[model samples]
Each structure stands twice: as C-alpha cells, then as structure tokens.
Target: MRKKWITTSLIAMFVLTFFAPLEARALADESGKVTFTKGLDMEGVKISVYHQSAPLAKENVKSLCFLDSYFLETGYCVTTGFEVGYNGSENSRFVSLTENYHLPIDLPATGYIWLETTTEDIFVEYTVSDYLYTRDVVYMDVFVPGQSVTVFGIGMSDASSLQLGEKIIDGKNIISRSSNQITFKVPSDAKPGGRVFQLVNPISNAIPVYVSPVVFNDPYQPSQWYLAQQQIYEAYDVFAGESEMVVAVVDDGIYLNHEDLSSKIWLNEDEIQGNGLDDDKNGFVDDIFGWNFLHGNKDLEVKGAHGTMVAGIIAAEKNNEKGIAGIADNVKLMPLIVCDTMGCDAASVANAIKYAVDNGADVINVSLGTSGVTAYSEVYNEVIKYANDHNVPVVAAAGNGDVNGGIGFDLGQFKQSPVCNETKSSDVIGVGALAWLVSLPAWANYGSCVDVYALGEHVVSTTVPIYDLEGGLYTAADGSSFSAPIATGVISLIKSAYPNISNAALHKYLTASSIEGILIAEDAFMLIKEQYTSADDFVAGEVSAVDVDIQAIFSDVPGDHKNVQAIIYLQQNGVINGYPDGTFKPENYVNRAELLKILVGGKGIFPDAAMYNNCFPDVKNDWYAPYVCYAKKEGWVGGYPDGTFKPDKTINKVEALKMLLNSQSVQLPGFVDVAPFEDVATTDWFASYAAKAKELGILEETGYFLNPGEEMKRASISENLYRLLTL
Candidate 1:
C-alpha cells in the first residue's frame, strides 16, 4: 500500500508571521472612525457588514465575505479571509484575495479574504467598507496529495517552492500571496479525483484548517433546478408501482410498518406475506420475497433507521396522505438489509447487489462503501456490470474527504475510495455532496472527477439506529449517505416512466431533461430555454419547433361556469393554444419569443423582413425572426444588453400578464379598496398585476393568484388566455 502526506512546515512559516503582530494592534476608536448617522454610502448592491457575532458569522466567513470588495469591479466570485493593519494606523481596510488557477484572467474556484476586525480584545477589527470598482488579483491555497495530479496555471514565483509530503506520491506548489492570500498551482497530473487544500490562520489552537477541494456538491444551479423534479414528473404519464419497476436498496433493513413505505414494499405475490414457510424455497425457510443477509435468520424483520432512510429517499408514499413525499410516490422498494446494526463488509454488500440483480430488481442503490478492495469487489463490480448490461442503474456517493485537502476528515483520502474507482463502471453514477449555501461552501468538494452534484450537506433524513431508538419508527439525520437515495429514487421514476428505455439512454434522457439546463427568472413562467431549436426541431413531440399547443388545458368551459368562464375567454381570444390531446399547458413555461409573438400577433402588428433581423449571436435568421422584429418594433420588449434575445426563455404569469396589461388596447380600472392576499405584500413586484387581474375578473383574489415571478402552469395560461379573449 502507498501512503501520501502534506508537509506542514513549509507553509507554517508564513502563517506564523501573518498573525504575530495582531496582539500589538490597538483598538478602533470613534475618533478616526467614519460612522454614518443615517446609513453609510453603499452602492446599489445589497451591502451589510457582519459584526462577527452575527448568527451567520461562521457561514459568512467560510464563504469569504470580504471577497465582495474586489467583486464589485469584476462581478466575479472572490473570497477574502481575515486580516489587520499596523496598530492604530491612519488608514484601515481589510484585504480579500482570489487566485485564478484555470487562467490569470478567468475566475478561480477558491481563495481567501481578509475580514474587517470586530473584536477589541482580539487585536483585529474587521470593519465593513464601501463597495468600489477596481481590478485586483489575489492568491489562494493549493493542496496536492498525489504526484499523479498535474499542476497547472499557478502564479507561483518559484518552482522550488513546491511542498511535498513524507512520500512524494505528488508535489504541491504554494504560489503568490496578495493581501492575506497565497496562490498555489494545481499539478497538471491531477485526474478526476479528490484533493485537499488547507488555510492556516495565526489564531492559536486552531490547527491549520484544511478545506476539501470539492467545494460544490450539486453542479446544477438552483434557478434552473427549481421545480425541475416536478417538470420531469409532468413529462411522463404517471405509472403505478405494479406497472413493472422494482427499486432494490442494499442497506440495513426496512420498517414494514411505516405507512408511506409499507404499501409499496415489494412482496413476492407468488408466496404468502408472513408465512413461516419458504413458499418459494430459494434457500432459507420463509424466504418470502426479500432476504436478510445480516442476521443469518429468516426473520425478515424491520429494525434500523439506515434501511428506512435509504428506502424513504427512494420510494416513500407520495400524496398518499401520509409521510413526506419520496422521489417516486409509487415505486416498489425491495429491501435487502445486508448491513448489520454497526455496518457491513464487502462480501455482504457484493452479495446483496448480486441478489438484487439476480432477482427482479431493475435499479440497485448501494449507499455503503468500504476501504478495502477484495475479490468481493470483483463480484460487486461484475454485478454492477451485469446490471448495466441488463439495463439497470447503480448510484453511489463520492467518498467524503478533505476534498480540498485530498484527505478524509477521519480516515484521510486515498485510504479507501470506492466511489472514485467504481464510477469507472458504465452502470455506476457516482454522486458528490453539495452544501445548501447559495454559493461558495468552503467545505463542499469540486472537480471533474465528480459527475452530477446534488444537495448533500446538512441533509436531514431517516437514520437506521434512530429506528431502534424510536421503537421501530422513524427519525432524521444528515449526510451524503442520504442524498444518493434521492437520486436513486429519481432513477426509479425515469425507469418507471420508460420501462423499455435502456439504462444508458435513460441516463442521457434524465441529464437532458435536467431543469438545471434551463435559466429561471423572477417570473416563474419565463424560464430560459437550454435546448437549441435548430438541432432537430424537438427531440420529443410534446415540445417541437414548428408549433406548441397552449389550449386544451382546462376541463370546464369558461362560458358554462363562473370559475372557468375566464379560462375559455382567453382561449377564444387566441391568447393561448390547446394541445392535441385537448389540454391547455397553461402552467407551462411560456417561451419569451412565443409570448412576444402571441402578444404582437394578438395586437395585429406582425413584423416584416427588415424588422425581423436580430443582432444576438445566439439567435438565428429563420427562428422567431418575425416575433423578434415585432417585439422590438412595438417597444413591448427589449433585448439583453449583450445583444442576445433569448426567445425560448419561459415567461412567468405576472410578467406575461403585465406585458398584456401594458398593451395599448387593454384598459383596467384601478381598485382603491381591494382585499389583499395573506401571502402577497404591498411591496411585491406583481402587486399591480394581481390588482389588475382581479379588477379585470381574469383572476379571483379570494382563491389564488400567485404573484409575479412565480412559475406559470399550462392550466393557468389557458384560463388567462380565455379571459383575455372574452374581454
């Protein structure tokens, strides 16, 4: 076995010098201080200085709060750590640093920022300053544990400055330093794997805090991902569990008593439910359907939180008026509790996966990994390969380590990396954890080595031990261990939706359908389109290039009932289209170009050839040309400053309706005395839209009228279209 370590002495020298002078600095008095009586001069951007004791101090600090200083100029992500100046100096400003590892010009993944002093007892006082515009580069920490990782694009002053551990499996370079940051070069030899970086501050007893290189868990952005799962569900017709998909979880054991999970648990209908006889007689007595590999008994009893947690993530009853919704509301959970109360070994895990594949399981989710590579690994890998050949998908979690340091917090990296290696299998989808922070979780790992990212940090879920603790019930805990199951559940959904789809093709389809590919806006309906219309028009019939159905989304015709009258009015008005299936996709995202075309076309102002020309690099000549020309001609909409007119972007109900209200034709009376929704505030952007929609009788304030920026559904669009036509 090979061992890798980091040389702390070389980097420790500067860390000692950086904080030694903090004790000599004096307190910040009101004399030279510039305190704003009303409020200090901060630019338009939201600005606030955390006084260190704020509840979110640790989080804000980890996110490199001070990096906002340099970012004001570049609008790029930068982090600034802690810093201080000479005692009682005339000028005072904390420094923030960022090192561009990819290129000197591009944004770097991680770095440090000098925080404004807050504590007087502590010589440092990170005071917040005004935002400004300037161009300045900073340094960062680079951690390399293995020589196989190739170092690249480092702004280091000397190559000899490279630091090596006790064993030279690799060499790490500590590059330049600006303000309070030190930049390091990433070795070019680095492959898609885990690495660790460290930050050493002078604070005593706070051993050099190491950062995991994997700073991000879910590579998918939030705006694009919002309601993505719902969209996926909408794309496919709902298929009940009995239809033909079975999700097998190789974990501790499942609670057959849990309401949400109980009904959906896979049962060998061929055999009796609780008969002590091995009706099928596979091996052990009463081997009803699923077996317990841990206890070596035919009890088939539900005992721990581990199996339940994993099961819940994959297939807890959804909308059944019970527990929290699982990824698939209706999917069979074939529980194979192989791990004991403490944990399990390679042999048991391998056998469990093999059992799932040998049996009727379509998708196998293994939430456990080990440090040892054994002949059983061959069995597991072979089983994974066999599952893949048979069109099954295996999802695993990337080992949690100092992704920043290339070492695990407890066991260190490289000791046992099952996810890193097993991912090589075509059937395996290795997942990494992402902290829930909006951006820059100092601890989340990042690298090409990771495939898809999901919410992993602080993730609360069912724990196996908690089951025994709560008496055969449920409890919640947090870990990447729990996240893998959600992904597994999502896979089960995809499989259930398209039973004949190959595992590889299903993976592609899921990735392609990922909402992360879409761009979201304040208006829920106006999401940006990620697909290129030029490619093949539409990969699927539901959304094609030539035409989109916007009507047929309602049940009760508008003229018949007061509630649905407005809905029909909009459709009659040509404000919306119905699908071939006679359903209106009212709530669906209204593409920007499509909305503009609808509005201009309704106004009878179609654009000509000359007006159809656009200047954006992304737009094409034949695509939405007339709509673009007409919108620009009518002053109804404008292109982004970059000259791009993103047409496929979805328009929210508020923005779409506001544009309608803004039209020269539509006139709405103002309401001085109208009741407001409990959730809608007067300061909301869509307040006027809501008010106007109510007066026009297009929307009823009594029931529901979601404000601006809320996602618009196909049904809502149909109703609005019908109302417009009636008006």
Candidate 2:
C-alpha cells in the first residue's frame, strides 16, 4: 500500500490551464487590483486566495488553481464535503460556514473551520465550531488500577433548545454554559470497568450520540476480545455448524428487522401478512408470522424486545459487511416477543413457549426466568409440559438471584417468604454464569434446576433497532441474560447437525455430551427436551442415552495423582474426568501457554488472556499463553510477567485444570480433545486419555503419529495443545 500524494501547486497549474478565463476576473474591478484575503491559518501559515466567480468554484477549477496552490504550500484547502454552519446577528448579511473534517485527516488539531460570506463578497474566517473531542473516546481509558472513573457525554436527543454540557471531575455540576468539559475522577473504592456514563439532556426527550471514531490503545487489552483469541477460537470451533440451525429466541422481543439477524429469521411461510385474520389458524390470531405473546398481537415493537440479544447470540450474521457474528453463523432465528412495557409475565412466557413449540423451532432460547413463587402456576406447568411434549427444547437462564438448595435456601434452610410459602417450577432447564476468567459470580443464581453453564462476562450481543441509522449495530451488555442465548446457540448447533434427534433426546444429549465433570450425569440429560408423563416420572434409575465411561476416565494418571486429587475425586464422583480411553497420562508435560483452553475444556471456563499473537518472539498464535492467562486470572496458574509460560514442561495433570474448576462451584467434564498419537497410547500410563478424547469427538487414531516420546516443539504442539484444552 503505497501512500499517494497530491500537491496544491500541481492542482493549481491544472486548474489555471483548464479554466484560464475564470482567473481573468481576478484582474480587478476598478483599481486594477483584486484584494486577496486570508481565510484560515495552517500551523503559522495563512492562506490567501483571490475571489473568483461561481463557475470557478467547482472542484475541478479549485483543485487546479486556488486549491492546488494553497494545498501544495500548506497542505490545506476547502474540503469538498458537507459542513455545519451558523449565522451571527453582528453580520446581518453574513453567513458563517464550518468545514467538517474527519479525525486523523492530517490536521494538527480536532476542530471545524468557519467561513464568512455575504451576497456579493466572500471571505474566510478563523472561527472554529464549538465541538468537543476527547482522547477517552477513542481509547477505553479505564480508571488506573484501584481507580474507577465515570466519563459522561451526550446521548440521543431531539430537542432544539437542548445542548450537551459537562460536569466536574469530582461529581459536581458545571454551573456555567462556558464550562462544557470535565472529567470525573474515579473513587478508590470503585471497581474498574463497572462504571459507565449516564448522559442526559434537560431540554430534549432523548438524544443518540454518534460514537466518536478514534482509535486508542485499550487500557484493558488483557480483558478484550483480540487478546483472548484462544478462548474465542475454542468456543468458535467446538460446535461448528453449517449456518442452518433455527434458535428461537423467545424474550422481550427482537430487532427482527436488523440486517445481521434478519436474513436468518424464520418466517411462517404459511401465514398471511396483515390480513387481520389467522391465515394459518393455529389458535392465536394473526401469528401469520411469529406471535407476540406480550401484546398478544402480530405487530411487535423493537423497543420492548429482549430477544434481540439472544438472536445475536445464535446467528446475527457472520463476518458479513456489518456488525458482530453469532456463535452459529448460518441459523434461523424465530423471535417470539413475549414481553411488553411491563416486562414478561409468566403467562406471556408460557404462551411464548407454546408458540415456539408449535412452530418449527429447532431450539427455543428463553433468556428470562423467575426464581420466586409466581402467581401464574398454570403458565409454568402447562408451558413446560407443552415445550417437552412438542419436542422443542427450552434453554432458560437460572434466575440471577441466589438459589442454592432452591430459592431462599442458601444456608441450607428455607429462610425467606418466597421459599417458605411457595414453590418454583423445576422443569425449566436453568443455566448459570461461569465467569470469563473463572469462579462463579456471587450474584449468579444456583439451584438444582440449574442444568449447565457457559461464558457470561462482558459477553457482547445485539440490541433492539435504532431507527434511521445507516448501519445498525450497538454493543454494551452483560448478565445471565446473555449466557442463556449462548447456550441456546449451542443447542441449535446440536439440533441443526442431528435434526432427527428427539427434542428430549437432544436435550439429554446436550447434558450428556457436555465437556463432562462440569455437570452430573442426570444434570447432562435432565432438561434437554425430555419426555415424561409428569415431573415425578423423570426417575433416577433409567440410564440416559448419552453415556460416559466412568471407570476408564479415572484410571489413568497423566501426572502425579496427589497434585490434582480434587480433579481426580471429581472424576470418580462423576464430576469430571477424561474421555473413555484408559490413558490418564498425567505425567505427560502440559503446555503452559494453553492453560486457558485447558480450563475451558477441562473445566468449562472461558479465559481473558493476552493473546499469544503472531508478533511475539517466543510466542506464536497457537501457543498456550492464552490458556495461562485464564489460569492466572482464575488462580489456576502463574507465569513470568517477562512474557513466558513454559508450556512444554510436564505439568502435574491433577494440578493442571483443577485450579480453575475447584473452589468454584461450577461443573464441567474431564473431556480433553487430545487425539491419539503413535507414542501416546491407552496402555502407556495415561489411562482414559484416548477414550476421553474420542468421547469428546476430538481425536485421531493412534497410528496418526502423536510422538509423545519426543519433546513437543513450540510449533508442533502449540495449536493442538490449546485446542485440547478447549475441546
């Protein structure tokens, strides 16, 4: 990419040659001299140009003569783009125009130019428009370690009189209009990355502030996506799909009209549009295409939809020309808007469930849930049963409130009114949040109903429609609210690949097919579309179709047994362990860098590690530094800050993945995706090694040359080692 240069003098020469007649007027009116005025200043250089007629104002003429001369000398000129301007009372016949220039446009500062002009004469002014630009806008200037700053800026507004203002850095309001800039110092007690600005305008109802386009080195790089490519890659490749699954997000609603998620939306082909009649006639009226359980109508508004984020989680169009990609790129998303202005009622939620079940939803995603007793008991029982009966699996979030032995029983006893006097439904498949690094968020609910977990930190997703915007895309969110959609996407992947699997069977398979140890056998098979006469009919004895090789998983020792006794014990109790192979090979050296992935696969925990990028001297893109990052964050492992994690050195297998899964009440499987190698055999001391790998669908046959006896090279084992942890 060679830089192109255009000199003003060259353009001037061309313009003079082409438009010689126009410059003839500059010869003067009566005094035989045309006054050349300085309009603006560049650095210390002032620009002077003779006033020319209208035809000479064209770009071709300006570029060749006036612009060419000015630009060649000072590298500045009248930008051929839209500009913002205003008129002042002092100059009754004068209008002031401001030239808008994009940032990093070879300018010394960030400000717009204002030109003054009258009917018969034009002159450039040195005035600049009152626009605010800040370094914080380009870079996420997180409050320094132990600091928490709250930056404020203008939001969307429609009022004419309203103007954006600023506040003091120390939480005080700016009294004078002259003071429009301020910084809020972070309090020592405030936690970093949790605070965001709340911009409000007193005059307008609301205002949508255009995001400033400035690139700055992210202070929180260790926590951003680019730096955690391994975790992203792990989650990406595990349940790879051909982009055809339909994940029905039944939430508040969705921006079904959004460009990214719209293409994959499932439209009810059988229904008619706006005919005021139930063309398909499936009980509800005008569900002609996707029902709205909240208003109980077909026409749904974008503002109230909670399902849009969930839709983004499943398939919000991939690496297309716009916005973010979903977990499953090519999938159909059927949005069932079940919430209104007051939020979703239990009855509405249940109705949404029934609608999704009745429709052809491969996977129904329910990002909302209730832990306390609900007034609508029928909605819960009936909808739960309907979803199961119709073979549509429901992936719901475990409520955000703590729900250990059940709601209101964290200390092992029913201590609150809700639990003491009421009962909650147990049929819904509940999911809880497992942090991006490790350890469960204290606020994340826990209960017997909680069936599984997934990444749920700064998890980005879709937002409802923002009207009249050129390219629709918005990112800023968190919660189990996001986790549920991710799980739903995983379900969609499974269903899309094996569509014939019964909803109940598929549900069982998900729990059954999970990475392992992270969930109980029954937990794995429990909520996925299950078939039973009643809740009580789901007894413990019937062996689930998705089976795990219990003994073979525990027998092998990859390293010293005492080191990772906790992980071993979990495996024995069916908490976690390797695949069905007999080789546990604990003594085999583990790559230090791939630890984050190991935790993801071995413990079901995502990581926030500095990516082992391509440019690093000793680290490659596939190195284990990323895994080590998650390990470091979650108290799983440590590395030299000097930028190295000796990954090839043998790690105590037990001490390896357990550091993350332990101390945290999360559950995952012992399924590492290590394919069988020539020297890495089941009988070679690593019992259950091959079986676990095979069970996890991540192995190659023994004859495939896995030279375990040879020292793993930085290049040879880096990528696969990371995948082994993630898979």
Query: Which candidate wins on TM-score?
Result: 1
lDDT of 2 at 443: 50
What do the candidate models score in CA lDDT, each in turn? 0.44, 0.41
lDDT (Cα, tens digit) per residue for candidate 1, span 1-727: 0000111111211010012224434223322222210111111111122222322232233333322223332233334332322222333322222221111111222332233333322112223322221111100112322212222111222222333221112233444443323444444443222222222222111111111122122111111121132233332233333345788887777877676577878876656656667666555565554778777665667655667877876666655544345656457888886776555667666667777766678788776643442112344655665565445677765544433343223222332333443422235665555432212133333343344555553333333434444443334443456656756765675555435344433343343343342211111111102211221121121222112223322543333443354443333222333443344444467777667655653443334434476545655564367666756665766777887877777877677777666653465445324535545566666566667776677653356546556656545554564455445
- Report per-prediction Cα RMSD to one decimal: 24.6, 25.8
Please give, for residues 8-87, the per-residue lDDT of candidate 2 as tens digits.
Answer: 00000001111123223222121111111111111111122343453222222222112222223223444343222211
Q: Where is the poorest 10-residue window by lDDT in model 1?
A: 1-10
Please list the residue runs of candidate 1 whose C-alpha ends up more than 4 Å from where it truly belongs after superposition. Answer: 1-90, 94-242, 273-278, 281-284, 369-376, 402-425, 438-449, 462-474, 511-727
- Number of the top candidate by lDDT? 1
- Cα RMSD, model 1: 24.6
